[model samples]
Target chain A: MASSIHDLARHLNISIGTVSRALNGRADVNADTRQRVLEAARTLNYSPNQSGRSLRQGATHSIAFMLQPHPGDQQYGEPFFIPFLIGLQAKLAESGLDLIVVMGAPGDYQQERLRRVVETRRADAVVLAWTRREDERIDYLTQAGFPFATLGRSRSGAKSYPSLDLDFEKAGADAVDRLVARGHRRIAAIRPSLNLNFAYLFLDGYRKALRRHGIEVDPELIASGFINEAGGYEVTPHVMRSKDPPTAIIFNNDAMALGGCKALAEMGIRPGHDMAVTVIVDTPLCRYFSPALTAFRPALEPMGQRLAEMLLASIPAFAGPQGPRIMREVWPLELVARDSD
Target chain B: MASSIHDLARHLNISIGTVSRALNGRADVNADTRQRVLEAARTLNYSPNQSGRSLRQGATHSIAFMLQPHPGDQQYGEPFFIPFLIGLQAKLAESGLDLIVVMGAPGDYQQERLRRVVETRRADAVVLAWTRREDERIDYLTQAGFPFATLGRSRSGAKSYPSLDLDFEKAGADAVDRLVARGHRRIAAIRPSLNLNFAYLFLDGYRKALRRHGIEVDPELIASGFINEAGGYEVTPHVMRSKDPPTAIIFNNDAMALGGCKALAEMGIRPGHDMAVTVIVDTPLCRYFSPALTAFRPALEPMGQRLAEMLLASIPAFAGPQGPRIMREVWPLELVARDSD
Candidate 1:
């Protein structure tokens, strides 16, 4: 179980260089010697170290998924990644590839982290999440000619790359249309303060939906919060304090919505009955809430599996017989209605 | 930014073998030649690939953490790991080492995963969680002479190893004592059906505490769940249907407790008023739940940091001036009294 190449050479009573050449299948090594070396290696359970093998093959046989750091010392924004990672890992396993999660360092070191992973040849490909509108990391990976796939779409890299993005824009507009149909005129949206590509896309659809209804989009009705429960708790009252507060509100995530609901309960405003609420749910938190939340649920596990497949398609070694195809897909979401809205 | 060793050698008008020898500081290479190669490598922005360098040094300079898979196809049990991972990555970064999360495959493939990580030299050390009583994984690592640290204590392996464990035994007893003080006699416990070491330790403490008060242990009062919300929701009524039902219940985790609370509400029973409730909290879920839950909070982020420190202390390369020391510690939990109990 703990045998090495040196041990193999010693046990076979052969020169170290001869054993290496025989194992590496060099033309100079005799066939009989190669067979003997292989048999001994199998018997000794001598698994070649990945470092030595990767050096010769120039492939790590591992894919890295960058876990983006949130603002400050906060935890990653969503619990959805746990299932997503499981799915990604399962798919990668089919190709005999290992999935390594590379955590982004705090603050602006994210780009540096990506560069190190690429420059050091730690992985053959990478999967990026928490994409920004103008992601320098994407641009860096693209210009460096490193293989990568993204969880969200970005408008940064010059060359198109494989990406699996949620239909966030459609979800946003649908939320607005649903509220408008329920006889709500003033609608509010709570999004992350960060300049994420999805947040911008969501607002685009929300504003467009308002215009389609001939309703004016008010600046006061749009609020930005940190992407956490406390952020939602703190911003709920601020948005409610507007001169003419919105009767209906849509939160960017379930965690924030949970906090907003708690804040509303303390303010004596009952959700569903008094103030209509909707959330972009990724976890079961909304399902078990006191008043089950109306949510747009994305099938995260399947999406994660697709993300891995798309990434593999872009890597020439893992691609199909037709060769590598850089794909771009917008995953669909299902709207589940509950008492909250 | 994408310079390779071949490009450097071609630019310097030297043989590739000569350049390699100079960079690796071989005795055969002259000092002047080595100095010239180093300066040219820096000027070209050439970063040595980790595979080649690690083969020579016998070190990957990376740590692998095993994210234990839960039962069936369920997501990893808790979201508390997000902050915990962030803490670990930050601490590892201090030593110029990277943290790579290795996801355990479904079913009984965990030991195989650990073996691959070690045999392939993918990481210099490992961090294991979801420890079981007499865990074979621990025994395997200890026997293989691999550096590792556990998040929970285990009664496995011939030699001692570094571990940072929670005081689950005390927490279980404290919960019972607190309930007893509040005039409760029949207390039910909901633990994971899995044979986790913590669950066993927790139940041991619970049983001892009930006996301390001269109360006989009732088999009907103990319940087992799948470590998720649905598991909690499903088992709540079953435990309540006992011939002589318990007046109070303690859930192993917050997600299950949240589901149990919902189930109680549907049955016309309020958590704090009709039945006392307590949870071993790892996330912010219980704090924001209606009738805020009584919980024991472990400082997860700092605990993660400490776990990293302990693991590094065991690795000779990362150890302090005094050399590697195998440390074992039990982390304390703070009981937060909420409205639920």
Candidate 2:
């Protein structure tokens, strides 16, 4: 292994300082020379000790995506994140940065994970997803003046940061509107038990839409469950057994909606026939469901790419000539009408 | 941020050498002092410049799990990896090592990914999954003398390495036996298009089982797909249209099996009654399917934990009193009989 800058410089017949500058992407280095040095470095396997290099240069050229394992779900929100990560990684690659996925340990909270990344100087920037209503992770990053971006918006951050969010509030309202248009006055909302920011916003829209339609927002219709299929299955029966049961239900996610459909099947109540159902979808699985669920589709892969671009715009070094821009984009979700609801 | 060893030492009123020794876990340091130093380091967030430290000590205290995105599937084998990662992280944490997930760039091959991890000195060791039949990544790691372990075995490597593999061979044979017992002579197998090691082993077992039963191994009966729902949905019809259509079919994975079931449903064929179905299951979705699928279940979380243990046993530093031992384990799959097949 050509272990150092000296070895790379010697092999390339170049000065050590010139080799260092080229490797660091210094503006002073000519494009041709920089390419040659980088090629040689990669070919000869010259790895500058990352910690040492970062301490001097103040850059790691890596982005950490802090992945919080879904509670009670081993798949870890696979449908959404896989495509999202592919997009994120693809975009980050264009900038010669690597995407480092850091999943928190079991029973380990999000704040601790974020702190570990920051404390270790693991990456120059971090990308956070599954934003909570009052997110301490966001607050901590903001206070540390860290360069970071979020996949969803949060209320706890003191300063505005770059973020890309789907309008869950609109989706919830739209589901209610669609169900109400079908002459259904009793509509229930099954949200995540976890204090996710989107859950609150979705409920907000659900309540507002009911009030606008001259229907009372019943507490009995609003229920929370774990975000997985099992959670959906368990909560569906509970909501159905309520004193004033809903004729329709809006689920937090596809997994929960799938479970709810199963529960409905067990009760001999067919979705879209005996009970209308709707879900906010991210994967193609929703379309393949038995009754083909009526879902709101957010183009996850493209959205992930956009999120990376937004994050890049926020970081001063990556922001190009226009300089850093604190981006806050609330993307719209398209309602895909299907057999269910 | 407590940026260096000096800062940590000064804060604790201890010499820099003592702090360094304690942090490094050198035998010269007393247990009480080591605990005190570690606690202070956590509290103060003292980040030893990792590259500098690793350069001198030859340990990154991190393990890289190289993730290869499924060719057409966006979920990236989520059902397997999430629980696997949780178990991996939990075990690795005990050794004070973090799990660093590294995904290759789009269209980038596995060897390149492995090389990057090694050349950059990103981790002390690596944990690879989805091993190819003749994996160049395995060969490369072996050639470089890099400490590594694999989730599946490979043929290309020169030296025997650590691995934890599911007995796909046995599963394939077992599926054939079960289908034959059900009086089905015409059996079809749907495998991944990717040149994975497991697929080959599965096919080997399948061919042997067919030969043993005096049943001709028809090329037309064996089909390959993209390893996703869409792939399964598309391939199922093609297999059914064969001159000698199969009465029973075995799918490579749960996702593909689900899609195949849909295709069957569209064709007015019930999976369990008209067309028997079986799959190599990894997730709970199989149990929830309309005709709960007949699958082979590999306790993923526990297996993942075992994989970590096996990998740890291979690495000298973390191997403890038993010392480094190259581990090769073949995990079994439990046959779960259900409505389908």
Best by TM-score: 2
Question: Model 2 clash tally?
Answer: 0
What lDDT does candidate 2 reach at residue B204? 84
Model 1 lDDT tens row, B218-313? 988888887777778778888898998888998888777877877787888888899999987546677767677899988888988999998888
The candidate 1 chain A region of ten consecutive residues with least summed lDDT is A69-78
lDDT, residue A233, candidate 1? 79
Off by over 4 Å in 2: A11-15, A22-49, A75-77, A243-245, A321-323, B11-14, B22-45, B75-77, B321-323
In model 1 chain B, the worst 10-residue window by lDDT is B69-78
lDDT of 2 by residue, B108-142 (tens): 66567677778777788999888888888888888
Local accuracy of candidate 1 as per-residue lDDT tens digits, A1-341: 56888999999999879888888789998899999999999899888889988998989999998876577427434566778887889899999899998887667647878888998999999998878889898988998889999999889996568998899899999999999999999998888864788888888889999999999999888888877777777788888999998899999878788778878888888889899999865567777777778999887888889999988988888898989998999987789998888
Query: In model 2, which residue pairs have backbone atoms overlapping below 3 Å?
Result: none
Candidate 2 overall Cα lDDT vs. reference? 0.82
- For every model shown, what is its TM-score relative to the native structure? 0.90, 0.92
Residue A313 in candidate 1 has what lDDT? 88
DockQ of 2: 0.49
